[model samples]
Target: MNGMWTFLALMMMISAQLQAQFDRSPWSFGLLGGMQRTHFTGTFQSLPGLYNCCKGFDGSSTSMDPFFGGSIRYAITASFGLDMQVEYVQSRGELSAVNTIGNALSFNGSGFDIVEAQSAFMMSWTIPSLGFTPSLAWKPFESGFGIRGGFTLRLQSNGEATGREELIQPKGVVFSDTKSTIRNDRKVNFTPTSLVYGPIIGLCYDMKLSESFTLTPEISYMHILNQLIEFSNSDESLSMSALRAGIMLSYTAFTPARLVEIPITPLPIIEIDTNKPYIPKRLKAKLAAFSVNEQSKEENIVNIVIEEYSSLTMTPLLNFVFFEEGEDKIPARYARLDATDTPMFDIDFIHTPNHVETYLHILNIIGKRMIEKPASIITLTGCNADIQKEKGDMALSMRRAESVKAYLEKVWNVSSNRITIKNRNLPEKHANTQTIMGAQENRRVEITSNEPYIISPIITLDTVRTMNPPIVRFRPQVETDSVSTWQLIAGQQDKELRRFTGEEKVPAFIDWHIGEEMSEGLATDSAIVYAFKARTSLQDSAEIQGMIPIEQVTLHKKKINRVQDREVNTFSLVLFDVRSSEITEGNAQIIEFIKGFVKPNSNISITGFTDRLGDADANQRLAQERADATAKALQVKNKAIVLGKGNSALYDERYPEGRLYTRTVDVIVDTRIDN
Candidate 1:
């Protein structure tokens, strides 16, 4: 025992020394040897006809046995393994009778003496067996401590039993021997069970002894489930339990280590001059030329020809007012009248020489005409785009018509019965449905009058003006290494007329139309001034200002020439679809109207324009194609000046409507009236 304790201490020291280097192997083989203490339970009986001292013995006994085994292990994972052990075990047991007999013995020589003697029976057995334990092993922590659980199968060889009688009291009386062997070694009456099975549980600790060897100390307990011995004469059986302690020396097969190589590259070095100073590139801008109609003449004067006329009549106002999608109210651009304001609303006071302005007051015009001619009736038909949010929405269409009717009834005092309101999915003369502009044009209210004159165009005697070289072109030159953005703002003095802005680089040329910019009112007859500004990404800026002279005609000179009345009419045909020069039905009608005003002595100007899309050269060709198509459709006899302006936006290109309006052909007809 002392040597055993010393060996355990030495193993503990070795385990501590090798703990860090310990690595469990996937396959291991080992040999194990141990001492086991077996506990015998139940009953042990004597042979049926051979017992001399007693019949049987009951209760339990404990004895020491020897067990030697070899194990093979397979690791399923880092912390779990399967172990199978085959062991040869020798088992032994002893049992004594609980009750002792006290008998009287008689001596013949004395003829009347009596002696009391007490005796007991003892029984013992031995079993030599081979045990197979297949178990699951688990190492729960990083340390070597582990636990194992499984069942054991034991196959027993033949076993032997013996019985003895022992004297308990009166040892020195008549009998001299205190103990006596009543039964010698004999085979058990019944054969020991051939096969035995039971459950076993164990604990172990692994101690590394070398690079490939591990020493494990383990303890286990097995409960025998079957009888070891059975008696034929009685209902007697025997069982045993083993508590075992052992050590295993195992050899672990290890795999060899491998090495990998990697390549390295060197970086290039850069040199710098210490005394040099760094300077950023500079930005530059120049107002190259602010001229009219790209003209290079020194006197860039825009001629404003104010023509006097005795009477001028605008015939046939457009009958449709367009609306936005999914809307029931009239657009704000249309002129509206209140009940109080209607009494003072005179047709002459509201009439404008501009056709677009006159068209905006169509509702008021219809209402005023209805008030004048009470018998005249008109119909208002509301239409929708018939797609997307407005698809099949008859109620919304009706509401839109009602909105128009309500305006005429409330403001103009036109009787509701005199005005008929109707709704439809789309206008009879619908534009291209696939395009956005076409869809927008379809959402409108159409007006028709019973009397032709009621909805006819407004006629007024007024003076009109035209600009010579109508377009004022500006060219700016910017020089920079990193100029981010630039802007050109044109105005008369302080009021900005038009502002053009762009990024990266400024365009080669920018144009401003005099008639269009001065539509509100001519601010000055002297000169038009503009400012050009440019900026870099670094916030550096450059600015310049320039002015263009204006040639103005006085109003008195127009009165003197009033006898020679001149009529000027302008019309625009809007192209909605991109890269399309085909004249739509509506545009064809507009061209017919233009042809009606054309005469042998008429001065006609037709200019075609494209939106800011596609390459400049392509747009130029497209504009020319549109102009040629319009000219051919008109079939005018007189000579006409036609031009194609490429990608020069006449309207703001940022909005869809503005871009749609830019793709157009403009025709202006100036006729001299013989007095």
Candidate 2:
């Protein structure tokens, strides 16, 4: 018995090591029918102090009986279950004993005494019972092997024990052998135990036959703890044990379904103000322009220098189109051209002085380039921000690249075979990922081409003019709680020379370049008036006017004085990755180029600028560090003017590329010709 328990414990440990593989139902009904082998044990005597034939007999019997039952199992979990089974079982066994005592003569008419040799007694009984078993079942393995343990309750029906006594004589003795039935097959005189209980341990293996059906083979051993019958005359009793083997076929009734929870947001409450009129907020605007010329001492007056020269303007193109976080489609800010509009799209016609505006037509520009260079192939590598909603979103990145690819294929008639699309978490050369602007810049698609001109700088020849005050800085201030719309218009007489508009709060400073068109218009006017208008959402409006004096040199006066024609050259070194002052090899090469353009009479000005990020003081320090580094790298003989402009919006700060372009040190060299 100890060995049996040891074996059972070992099986449990092995089963626990395996993983559950089958999906079991909660409720199952099964029919079980099998054979039970009962072993009976005890010491019994038919008659206590009577003949030695039935005295001091070791009682033992073994019988096999068929039992049929039904069981119901409820699975509490994937591995645990409760089982109940009821069956009708029968226990049948026979006990026989033979012994020889003192010889006895059989009563006969003859004078000879016959010696009785051996006496024997044979007994057989049958007990029918109704058995109920409730057990806890555990299935710990994916192999469908399980174990169950419980107690069995049996209620016995009317049962009886019958016995026959026999006497055997020697051959020499003429006494006839005597045989008589001592007990009939009727009910026994002593009452049997009506109720029996014992512990039962079983093992079973489940074989899944179908989706809702399973067949299991089981074997169990039960030992009755209490005696079945006790001899009234002696201190001896009879007990029985059973080993049952059977198979059960079960059908699943139903399995519970898992429920998913969804959260619902409640609607917000709104109140209407019908008792009072809507009063608009008061709005006020201020406007001023700072001179960039060293000759002009006043802030409102700017000296202009117009020179005639055929120059090639090479605008280096940024090969990335940025996207919003968690978005795959192209933003509306980028200009999209249809197939019908492709013929009318001309890169040469785009003459905006702002390079960012020209960058808005990047797709059209690429398409036009592809049309011109048919052998060129390009790859679009999409990237995600790798944080927040966009973290490790490779699918979204691929979709963004595909979006660009689809636009090119559909609108530009570019062959799909020429374009290759790829995706990754972030670009190879990405910006700082810790900041919001940095993450925004990282979420973009990079365009690379095998042909150089396809992505090279856009070059155009135009009549270039140099201004004494190269930059006209506009300072606009608006006093309003909320600004719905604002516009600053710089005009010359009846014509609008330049206009800047915004929906958000007005920036502290807006810089306007003295381009060819603006310089021509400003040459005729002594002063340029700028009008500032602002309004709130409630239609409360304010307008202000400001004038900047212009020191203009007329064409006839320049011819009389034989004024020397001065040429201006500007070079920019953009720092994209970090805010450090360390100059890279590429920046060193640009510095060498700027050094080559510097003549003895050339006035060199190096201005360092930073984006609208971080503290103003810190930016100022960083900008100064960057400018000093560039000046040291130039190693020029003449002293150069170096200034650090901190967070002064040189370009539109709303775009990532604009922010990147703002973090730069620009070298402008103005040299006069002696003719």
Candidate 3:
């Protein structure tokens, strides 16, 4: 576990270093040549017969001549960095000895000495946050420092040897024929802890260099204890001290890191019936009282029921209401707490946990999408229409819009600075339509924009396989009436569709009759309709397995220039029996459609249209809702430009009641020229 933690910490350190390595700062990197002075202190009694090895000599604390070396620095920001340095140094100490009782005898006069040398590598960083540099001088007030201890190898070189002297009276000297080969010896401390620490201090400096580089000169010091120890015939203790100074040069490249922004919105809502009556059997001892709809023939109140376990009855029971609309206003008069002979009634209202979670999920998706595409514009419309219609007032709509904007600004990183809300009056068609299904489509928020954004996958089946060539279809501007069609097939064949390889001219398969069954003006008046069969093989069975259910349609529109100004329309589908904005089972199918049909760098024109099941204005809004939903899905897939229209102008002479079939989303792809 310790090793694992160490490895994890190392990885985290590397990651942080990489992330911060590119931060913007005034940086300089250059070779530094400077001098450092060191001295020894502490315990010289451990070894005897060595330099500074007298029997009672204390530790020597003395300064030595300065040595030369170099250093390098990488400043991560204006205040922090990694600094490495190395230096070569020499140190020394000495002691004197005295001889006794040789008035007439001869003796040699000499002194003992030891010279020490070492090389070291120290890593440390400077803390500029502790103080600020003076403006006029370009020097820091104070800089903190950190360092790693270094190792040293000791060597002993005997300078002088003392000779024995003869006494004046009656004493004869005896000589032996033995010589010593251990005149000089050295020792190396192998343990890591043998190293000592040094003092770290703040710095003040001035920086100056060429246009692309800079130079910073700094000073730091370290102090070590226990330098003099004496062993048999030798002294080994060594105290350490250093004063270092150097200049640093650096070249900097900075890639800034900024927080991403997310744009969040409120969840679209649809109301369901919450009105019903309650009854209980075995009405013993007036067990509980019930409430009913206040406006109805009965009263709308909370009902409390309790089953009798035995003769004893509990006086209090808990009644909880966990689901309530956010905008609901509970009236105090409606709080029926009656303690009559019949029993008492009380009401409680609360929001379900599921409801809150669902709303948060919607807002999260919006925020994530916004972060991915920061410059995109988002328009919110159509919420609170039902409340306004019911009350015949526009205040509800305004409140809804403001609430949504607030949620986005507070919950998401998106600032109110970028958001724009338009509180539109209810369309005349929705004046009195209140069916549950109709109201479901009415209580929605539509997102829209005019900018051309990509709304398709970066890759597709055609880009991967060759068996079935993809088909490309487009509708020119309805007002311009310059429509075109073409087929891209793999294996050549003489039939309904044509094939094109590379930049060959786009083949035209003119079959305007396929749309004859569609309402006359529905395709062009409100929106354009374009559909194609997925190209399949007759012999190969595995070729079409697991393919997208519908052929993905790519649109290209033409205006003035054939290559530069066209817009591509994003196409999508809405599943039945579910709200348009909710993420349900149908979402997978929507993704498939984008993958099969949309392409990168393609622009689209999406016109929303609805069946005549609801009033004209309501249908128009529903169409817009579908358009907005399609655009949202497509935006996730890739990029696109989307426009929403309400009801189709196309009409049918026969089977006029079947307008629902005509309700569709039209996508026009542009090669160039028109937007």
Candidate 4:
């Protein structure tokens, strides 16, 4: 029993390591259990009372009991493999014999009474043990029928014994005879407790339950190779063996030790067979929550500013509300003057919450998409329906363009180089110019640009037998005349592994793996599959697969490129005098540099550092004061930001040469992205 427990502990450790090794192999594991017939064979030295029990026995006995176990099997090839398992079994055996004993006795005063010993006797033994089995298995021609040959290593056993003895005796006076069965009970704490080994042979059949699940039935016999038990002070030796048969069930799947998941948008695939006619699909390519009714002519009356800088068109999601804001109560910022010298109607830029929300929505989509494709550029061209009395139409249009550009640069962190403001200063050339709708239609900004930005619909499938080849089918909403061509591409890392193309507008029942020519884009180890549809020059990424489940991946390539542009400014740091918030050197140089390099929309941040010779709090204050002084020095300070770091500079007075560099200000600058 102790040896069994020790073997169990070792099995746990081995199982963990084997789990990784067999994860990719076509293998199965099962819980094993069965019943076995076991027996002990040997002779015991004669003892005071039990001498006849052993020496007088002329026959041997065997007992049937139940045993349980677990097993793991791995195939080195299609027909040959290894099976390892641990089992526990307990066996009980009994020896019984019938004998007759009688003797003539001298008489008492009257007559002699006779008794006969004609009864039964029984002696039993129980042995419990843990066994480890390692076998070599063969499954001919990839069939389920298999044969295994191995050895069972038996551990020390938990032993016990019990017995019963009975006889007939005389209990009557002379000339009277009566008989009764006299019995004696026997019990002993003994067992066949020693290291033992035996040969094992078995036959089994594997029945599959699912793609990765299976059940196996087997029967095995064990023949002992050595004596299993010996007495300490008596000349007794005992050995044992067994036979077991049972079923085992197992799964060859991932039993996760730890799990992580990420939500992703799956790109949709359009199955296109150029062989079929093109039809409109239920492709709602409108802005969020709004659909386009082509029959109507600009029903919402949104300002449409067309610019040549970027290629994203603003998807307007408003009713005619912008064309309906009360011109009489226009905010001072959005207000324009008239002949009465009063504010007149114009699309509110900042006053109303609803208008701001719409503005922000458009900006967010445009901004985020632009950031994704940095090569794209955006131009804001402003327009007016009529000239204002206070400021000419050109000035008002320029102001609107500037306001829109500032919002993007400040709130969205759009780079200045990527954005341009072009003032049209012209009224709506379309009919609504004399009406309110025309005014709103003429006052707007246009965005014109395009991965990794998740939208909706993720694709995934459970693991399948890679050996048998798998298929993926999807039900797509293919509205007639909407989608032109659908594209499917599967890839790993950053490379395009495979691509499947179709022009058919019918519902797609496409192969997950197209032929090499069609799937030329896929490099295919394991990767995310993306689906796209072509519309003009731009492609819409409609869906993405979380993972591609492939069996027996011989080579896996993980190429990760983390490109972080770490840039350093060549200009020298500004040095400061002791205990002063004044620029001691390079004041003129910094001013000149700011004038040359910093754009009007650019943001400047000056952080001040100090020597560790003063109170920490006071030094922090001094550093801030010094930064403020430097900000004041710059000719352009409208967007300059400042801070202090006390003694937490890159250099400190911890070493002999650090103090000189501590009292300085480091200028770190970046564009404004208001959170």
Candidate 5:
């Protein structure tokens, strides 16, 4: 009993621990399949009344058997659940005793006797988790496996029993009745009702059947803490065990079914009249220019109805306006126009001019707007004005388009090449006395591509040497009014910045030299100009990280200082390593870092060094190898430099901490030419 409580408490702790790791639902069904072993324990309250010696016998020997069972589960979510199971098991036990008192007066049995018992049984089980259950499968790698444990209450145990028992009642009276007898009992109760607690290890397989339905199969084992069965003759006890397995089919339904919504009906269309004395206010402003060449006004009353637009004069306006109060032309405000945030005459159409006159006329209005808003696209539509117009002919109206183009370039200073002259290709209905008053209304112009008001690019400037050339930066435009800035933010990774833009710049050629001779003695070398940019906060921190090993060309090198700081042949290397000396790894990081530094023609210098661990000769060899290795890593199609200082004293002995300071690489940049 004590062990049972301890095991139950332990299971509770484990369940609670697992519950906190995931999200669990209110109810869950699990299928179980496992084995169980059992042992029997307990004292008998009373023995058979016919047997005097069996009254206080101790059951010294016990036996157990394996069984199969299953459980149904209802979870309250993450912390607790209710469980039920049924099992079929068979068990055996032994008892021994001697008729010590019955042997008096020489009427006694000489030896002690043993009784054996065997039982076949079935039990109903109910268990509740002491702690909450998990809501979700926490370990994906577990492949839908979890652990559960709690205490169980055996509700009912029902089964048949058949066993043989021998008894020694008295020596002389009917000794035959004391012999072993086969007895059969039905529905015998074998186990006591008590809390059976143990650890539960299970695997949960959640099979998605559809959007709402899920099929879960699980197998678990429960270790009983105390023996469930009691001997009919003694107080001795042992642990009881049972096995269970089951499967359940379940379903789920969600509300508010998804479907497509009906679309709203369109508004009714409206018509207009240009010849009417009082024009509809909405259609008048959209017409930029229109004139009625009426030979006789008495009978030829042209009624015009045009569409309304924000700008570009394509809608209702001058072309469809009626002359009221003897006005030569209609004012934009008087015309019925579409009320919009954009004002009249403020719209510009970008065009390539084929007709100069109309082009210029339109440019004047657009250029004035450009002066006010430099970042606006200008559009034009029309042909030369000198072309003759035949009655009811559309193509003839565009012949004089050159006048529009010429006027725009000469007076408004609009580029003639930029102007576009496309004929309106007017259909009679769009212009028939209702839409357009006459031929003039059929000719027109528009503005296109606006440039300016874009955000500046973020620049990353990296240098092999501060003495070399400067870095160059640029950006591309895809369309009007849309621009993304190029910047390197602190601590932001380079790949993250690259997601926004695709350009990067890196330092030029890097060089490495050993001493001064080609094969022996002293050697010197240099690298060509390269490009570079600095890491943005997003790319990395501003504080120096590790060194980057670069290719020779990336780090340009030139002999600037002597071997001993005295006047000597000097070389410059552009791309070189920074914190890391591992030429390969460092080079990879450097190259990736350069992806966001898209600039051009950045000349840098490279200077390589080594630690004083070895002799001058060994140190020189190591330093040259390090520099050369770094240089080869950064070599791209672009010009880069490599420089190697063969242990000619770069760092002092005071910084003998490691190669960190002793084995150092530096870059110098020069900014003069453009590459």
Candidate 6:
């Protein structure tokens, strides 16, 4: 049939198409619809040998009908797959015949009984067949196009057959012939129920609409192989064939067994945790300092290794905490502090609370490295920042270096064998580098490795040399590097006293021993300051500054006079403005609380606190100044201790009211002590 030729032609054209397409997955399914024409074939069983009127394939026997249904597909591999479909394919047929035939009476020999003839007849057959078909399909290439074929079980339901004959009798045989036709209303018929088996074949192109859907266009053909006619008194059959080209739209639940891969680069792993004290991002940047641009081909990050870091005194990459503007002796009060990139000296910065904190943190980090690799050693090379020092510079640098070495051994319990300290004090070897920026560089202790370098072990001398010597060289040191809880019972936050040099339970305070002459007849208890320090194990030596609290006065009363009655009074001072450490003249009324509660011998304690604002260091300094000025304003002749306990949770900085609460000093006085 021409239809078969067209189907084959379509197959040939599309099979060579650009297979550039969406990937087909393992399974898919969708709907289908299209149209087809049927070609019928059958014979009359009544005659047993003759073909029926509409039995043969011709112009009148073929009809077009709708086709619709759904399909499913399974992909076995990249290029091979199987598919199946169920669809509605049906055709209706009608054949009619009308004719006028000449009837002659040849009466030359025969009498009047010879001439009875009919000249007109009419007949029709209506065949409407509905079918439910199923199919199996496959594709040999890695494309959406494929071929499918299977059986159609057709139930021919509505069919009819009818015929009529007419006679024309003229008044005289030719002039007035009466034309008559016998009419039949219900003519052609088919068996109400009959199973018709047939084969169907199609060329379908499976097109993907999206991940889960597909569309298919097909050219399909089928032949009904069974006879399908049931007329009373007539055993006739109609075998039908169809040539159809249909476009079916389908949706498939297609899931691919493999997906296109995307390349990814893993980020370098560094430990980060919210709950734990962590290396801040700034510190990480400093630790990962690169001398080269990011676009460069060279790898800039030095691997962090325990063995390399454990054997060297790592100078903190941080600048030294410098002494305050004028006075120095660590602190004349608790101990004034100074900053240095160098290790702590037994001589100076050990007394500085800030310097002590910094030193502890650095050591904790170093100790952490050493702890990770127990078979490691650290070398400490200490140098003073002041290259201009004519005297005691070398001694000062050596003392600082030795202090760090001793700390690792004593506090962290690292074996002294794992650490070696060296003094680099020669002016020729270590210069002041005299510039402000360079001066801090000299103040810092430099570190070197007995093992290999990792983490780009910072390589430089503690002091820059005035002149280079062939015999002496500056070595590299790998420096590997807060919730406040303060509840004031009196003027001080009651804290557990920590030991600086001993294992015993340290006393709260030791007497100042300023003696009777210095008392100025005020009869005040001399204040004594106690050195406090707490040591603990660390991966990197870490101490949150606020974790351990300090107070305005920690010294216990002398108890020389045991007055049984101890009168206690508490007052809140809210006189200061934001970022200001001065008490205003209008707020002099706050001093009245002090005057009312104090005995001449009362050990007055004044502590100033601030809201959590700005940098922590600046906030703390402001607090201290405020407390001192408040004490000066009170004009207390007795021994008075002023403390600045930075920020307190007593106030939430989120609102003005909470911040006002924090911007106050708390005072507690006991009038019961004997003067």
Better of 2 and 4 by TM-score: 2
Which residue runs does candidate 6 get wrong by more than 4 Å?
Answer: 1-27, 45-60, 76-84, 96-130, 161-182, 187-189, 230-235, 254-675
- Kindly report which residue pairs in candidate 1 clash with one another: 316-457
Please give the lDDT score at residue 465 for candidate 2: 50
Q: Among these predicted structures, which one has the highest TM-score?
A: 2
Candidates 2 and 5 compared by lDDT, better number: 2
Evaluate residue 293 in candidate 5 and report its C-alpha lDDT on the 0 to 100 scale: 27
Give me the overall lDDT of model 1.
Answer: 0.75
TM-score for each of the candidates: 0.40, 0.44, 0.22, 0.31, 0.26, 0.28
Q: What TM-score should be assigned to candidate 1?
A: 0.40
| lDDT (Cα, 0-100) at 559 in candidate 3 | 24
| Local accuracy by lDDT, each model | 0.75, 0.78, 0.35, 0.53, 0.34, 0.48
Q: How do the candidates rank by lDDT, highest first?
A: 2, 1, 4, 6, 3, 5
lDDT of 6 by residue, 135-237 (tens): 5677765577787888877766665655544445422344133332343323434454466777888787867765465667789878767666543444455
Regions more than 4 Å wrong, model 4: 1-27, 39-42, 45-55, 99-116, 168-182, 231-237, 254-675
Candidate 5 lDDT at 38 equals: 32
lDDT of 2 by residue, 1-675 (tens): 999999999987765543133344589999999998999986776522223335655767888899999999999988899999999987887777776645765555666574746655676777888999999999999899999999999998777566665544443332234233232223353356789999999999999996688999999999999988745855777889999999999999544445557898998989978998976557877777677555534465444444454343445577888898898889999999879999999897783556777778899999999999999999999999999888889999999999999999999999999999999998998778888888989999999999977876565656665566666777788877898888888877777888889996788888777653475556563567888888888788889887766555544455677876556666677743477888976576567666777788878888888987988899998888888888888875248899999787988887898887788887777777643
Better of 3 and 6 by TM-score: 6
Collision count of model 2: 0
User: For residues 47-148, what per-residue lDDT tens digits would candidate 5 score against the true structure?
Assistant: 222222234443433343444454455644443445555443444444444333233232326864543332222112212112122222232443434444
Candidates in order: C-alpha RMSD to true structure: 29.6, 28.3, 36.0, 35.1, 40.4, 38.0
- Give a tens-digit lDDT track for model 4, residues 167-260: 5333331221223353456666664646788899989898988647788888888888876665565456566666777888877764434434
